[model samples]
Target: MRQQLASTFESLKVRNYRLFASGQVVSLVGRWMQIIAIDWLVLEMSGDSGTALGFVMAIQFLPVLMLSLVGGKLADRYDKRRLLLVANIMWLILSTMLATMVVSGLATLWHIFVFAGLLGVVNALETPVRQSFVSEMVEPKLLPNALALSAATFNAARIIGPAVAGGLIALFGSGTVIAINAVAYLAPLVCLLMMASDQLHRAKTKPTDTRISEGLRYTARRPDLLLPLALMFVIGGLGFNFPITLALLAKTVFNTGPETFGILTTMLAAGALVGALASSKRRERPSSHVVMGAAAMFGILEIVVAFSPTFWAACLLLLPTGFFMIYVAQAANQRVQLGVAPQFRGRVMALYILVFLGSTPVFAPLIGWLGEVVGPRSGLWIGGVAGLLAAITAFAVRCRKRDVQISVNLRPRPQVRLIEPERPTPAEQPA
Candidate 1:
């Protein structure tokens, strides 16, 4: 048990990662609080219009879709720590501005949209650099654990942030929450400043002539890389719009306020926390089958949550929904990061971020519109269906590529299994 615990948190033994993780824990909690506040503020301002919320989300992620690749190129050529410091400073400034606007009662929906877009631009640059920076902070063997622990920190914040924000919003209003988040940015900035640069496993800087197209071409040739990227693109574009979906569901379906919404979000985060911790125990990169299987399970759970009869039931269901969601993500991320060449890590991860998050710009508004037109539960239904289809498609394509057969048996406790192609005897060889 002691050895297992040590292996799970092995990355934290690295001083740089320990510092980075410590600062990130504080900062991410604030960030998640800010997200909850922003979603709530949008709902209150827009008279609970899911479409408006979706539009804001779209604006926020548009820059990620457009500029993440460029950000990746910059990461490849520059110092990631310095880049992240700059990004966090910008975040502090922006969050402060938004807080002041809100507190002064001068904020409009357009003001929120503008700020969201600006933050999105910063995120485009920060995300890829941040994702690839894990490798620089720890040894190669510890990469998977580091990534998983990083996710655990995010989800832990997810669990804490919303619960705290919900209560804070109830008492002091969202402006205060926003202001607090602005202050939280200082933690990471200070952490970055204090990091010992000599300790980083920094990749040698690439030449200025390195092109974004090179990353694309490299990904095109590797099936191992392609499968996870493809899954992320499909599932990410269609299935992962929780901010818009959950807020709308709470307001329209349950007729609840920020507190209940926070509870719902927290439940999902709780499951995600469990998933991240579980993933941290894995010493090796996960297989393609594991990634797809988790996705399928997540989809099924989302569907179950959609059909939930009560608010508490939906909350209970979100736990497993969140688990599969993060499990698939972590598995796919480990696969891509482990498979890529070091020089291409930033660019390839940018593509991963592009597909996983950048696609939000295209899908967020659509899901929001669907919630308004179809039903409050429509987003979950659509997400679940998309996940199921994406997983099934990936499985079919993989089996065909390997010349393998697949079988399903239902009579004796349902099971689906892959059957490998048989190898020929030595006599059949061309000797």
Candidate 2:
């Protein structure tokens, strides 16, 4: 078991990846803290409007849609370590400013919204760079492990950060949580600077390039990637998004406060972390079969969550729901990134981010409206059913595509005369 765990962590053997992962762990925790604090603060400040919550999420995800291509282009063109450092520094400055304003009681809903939009812009620059950076520091075989570890650590932060944020919000306020997040950005900046160039392996950047469109062309041809991307539009955009559901579950179903909501979120994160670890332990890339199965299971479990009679059960269900959901997510990401070549990885990953997150705005309002109409439970029904159908379709498509091939053969033909008798080909052909 110990050896198994060590092998799973083989990616961390690289000093550069180790530093990046460690700092990201710290930074992700801060980010999660801010996420929870902001959600709770919004609920309190605005009387728990579902539309407002969705709108906030829309602002954050909106930029990811518009700039993912540009972000992808940048990731392929520039030094990713430097890009990440700059984004973190920007976040630090913005977070500090927000903290000061909130602490001084000068913060308003519009203030939070505007700052949230700015953070969205920062992530537009950061997400693709961060996603592509791992390959620079690790071998091809080690990449799945690296991505899995990244997801696991990120999920672990989700578990701890929200719970801690809840307590901090209870003890102090959202301002302190924001301040802590600002300070935490320094950890990643330092890690980025400390990463050794010797440990890096960047793809050759073209001094003059038109290859951004080439990445899109490649993805356009790959069914394995295309199908997963399409399903992500369904699952991530419609079924898998948790923010709108979180507000409804907290305010309406559970009748709980921010503290309880945070606990539920933490439990969900714990489940997702477990899923990440389990996926990382596998020796091979999970097939589309695995990805679809996890997605289907996630949808079913979500229904179980909707029908749960009490807050504790709902909290418990969140773990399994998150576990399966993230299992599918990481599997899909690993397949898409690894299946593409190093030269095209940045744009490929950018599309992955866009497909995975870009549709949230379109679906969030629709789902929020469902919550308002038939209730939160009904909204889960839509999510569960749609997600299951998407997964099943993806699975079938991949299975059908297996064993496909085109035959080619080269054989010497009897010398044939051109514009002459078949027997008189000595002069006409290579007799």
Candidate 3:
């Protein structure tokens, strides 16, 4: 069991990955704690306005939509380790500022918005760079495992962070939780500084003549990447708006408080953690078919969860919802990363992040509005339908490509096999 457990977590076998993952576990938990606090703060300050929460969320990702391409280029041009260090430092500073404002009782709605926007700027640079940086921590063969483990750690933090934040908020306030998060940024910064420079899988230096549109063009020409990205755009835009959806559900649907909200979030994270761990155990990379299938499952689950008659029932359904969600998510991530060449990884990943996150700004307000005007269930239903449509579209594209390949290869070619005569020479027969 011990050996099996170690093998299952093979990415941690790498010294660099071990250090990085450990720090990230701590940092991401803190990050999630901050997120819960911020959302609660917004709701409190804005009089439970879902639109206000949506806007804050949108502002946080707008920069990623605008500047991720440039960030990807910078990731390719600079050392990832050093770039991450700088980004972490920026995050630490920003977290501190937010903490101070809140603790001092001077934080306003505008202050939160401004801080979110600035953090969005930091994330634009950090997301793509960090995506590409994962490859440097482990061997190429272990990339799938590493990526799965990375997702697992993130979801694990999701479990701990909100639970901790909810308790902290009850005992103290949002300010205290935010302050705790400010201290949490130290883990990743220290870990990055401790890594050996020579161990990193550095990209070859590229000529300065490369254009910013290079990654866009590269991704545009490949159906494998283009299809998954389209799927991500649809699902990520509407389906992944959990912060907004869950918060509204807790408030409007269940009429629950922060503690119950935290429990629901933890439930989703628990399922996601399970899915990610299962994904990590696979030795081979997942196919697009697998990705689409998982996505379809996710869509179906979302629709089911939307109609749950009670909060407990809804939470029960969210377990499998979270499971398939991570399966689809990690599968798409693995497919894209494995398909792209190393040189373009940064830029390609930027596009992936764009679809994966940036599109949220475009759809979040709409989702929030739907939740308010129609009902909280409306957002889930729309997201589910969108996910189903995206999956069906991807399936059609995959079939079309396969049919085209079959037709192209149907023409007969001359047989090149050498005949082995019964009357072969004795020397040849013996050999």
Candidate 4:
């Protein structure tokens, strides 16, 4: 048990990762709080209009779709730590500006939309750099663990942030929550400043002329990488619009307020946190089968939650939904990061973030419109169907490419297995 525990959290033994994780714990909680506050504020301003809320969400991620590739290239070319420092500083400024506008009663829906766009621009640049920087903080052997723990940190914040934000919003206001997030940015900024540059595992080949197109070509050539990326794009674009979906569900479907919204979001995060920790115990890169299976389960759970008869049932269902959600994501992430060459990590991860997040702009508004038109549950089931289809499609393609055969048997309690293709003997070879 002790050995397992140690392995699960082995990355914390590194000083750089320890500091980074500590700062992230504080910073990510604040970010989640700000997310709750922003969603509530938008709902309040627009009178619970899902379309308006979706528009803001779309604007916030549009820059990621447009500019994340450039950000990835910049990460490959420059110092990642310094790039992160700059990004955090920009986040601080933007959070502060939004807080000031809200506190002074000058904030409007349009102002929030504009700020969301600006924040999106910063995120486009920051996300890939920060993701690639994890490789710098830990050894290659610890990369998978570090990635899982990073996700655990984010989901841990997800568990705490919304609950706290709900209470604060009920007591103080959205402005106060935003201001607190602004202050929270200082934790990461200070941590970055205090990091030991000498301890970093800097990449030996820092290619200054790495093109985004090269990363694309690299991914295209590798079916292993392509499979997960394709699955992520479909599931991520359609299945992961939780903010809008949950918010609309809370307000319109359940006739609840921010506190209920917080609870619902917290339930999802709690399950996600568990999933991340469970993944942290893994030493090897996840298999494609594992990724696909998780995606299928995630899709199935979302569909179940869509038809939940009561608010509490939905919240309860969200727990398993969140687990499969993070599990598939982490599995896909490990698959990509582990398979790619070191030189292309940044640009390829940028493509990962692009598919995972940048596609949000295209889908958020559509989900929101669905929420407005078809009913809130439509958003959930639609995403669920997309995820299920994506998983099935990717799995079939992988099996066909690898000449693998799958068989299922129901006589012995329903078993399924894959059979590897037999290789031809040298005597029978044409050559």
Top candidate (lDDT): 4
Q: What is the lDDT of candidate 3?
A: 0.86
Q: Which lDDT tens digits does candidate 1 get at residues 139-255?
A: 888888999999999999999999999999999999999999999999999999999999999766565655899989888878888889989987887788898889988889999
Model 1 residue 333 distance off true place after TM-score fit, in angstroms: 0.4
Error of 1 at 120 (Å): 0.4
Candidate 4, TM-score vs. the true structure? 0.95
Q: What is the lDDT of residue 280 in candidate 3?
A: 89
How does model 2 score by TM-score?
0.90
lDDT of 2 by residue, 1-431 (tens): 89987998888889999999889999999999998888777777778777677778788888989998788888888888888888999999999999999999999999999998899989987898899998899877788898999999899899989889989999999999999999999999998889898768875554356366887887887776787788788889877667678657877787877777788888889999999998787656567677788889988998788788888888888888989888989988887876776777788899998988888877877787778777877667788888888988776665344422233444464453323233442211100
- Deviation in angstroms for 114 in model 2? 1.0
Q: What order do you get sorting by lDDT, best first?
A: 4, 1, 3, 2
Give lDDT tens digits, candidate 3, residues 137-226: 888889988999999999999989998988898788898898888899899999998898888777656546446787778787777788
Tens digit of lDDT per residue, candidate 4, span 353-373? 999998889999999999999
lDDT of 2 at 78: 83
Cα-based lDDT at residue 262, candidate 4 = 97
**For candidate 2, what is the lDDT?**
0.82
**Model 2 residue 74 lDDT score:** 87
Where's the lowest-lDDT run of ten residues in candidate 2? Answer: 422-431
TM-scores for every candidate against the unseen true structure: 0.95, 0.90, 0.92, 0.95
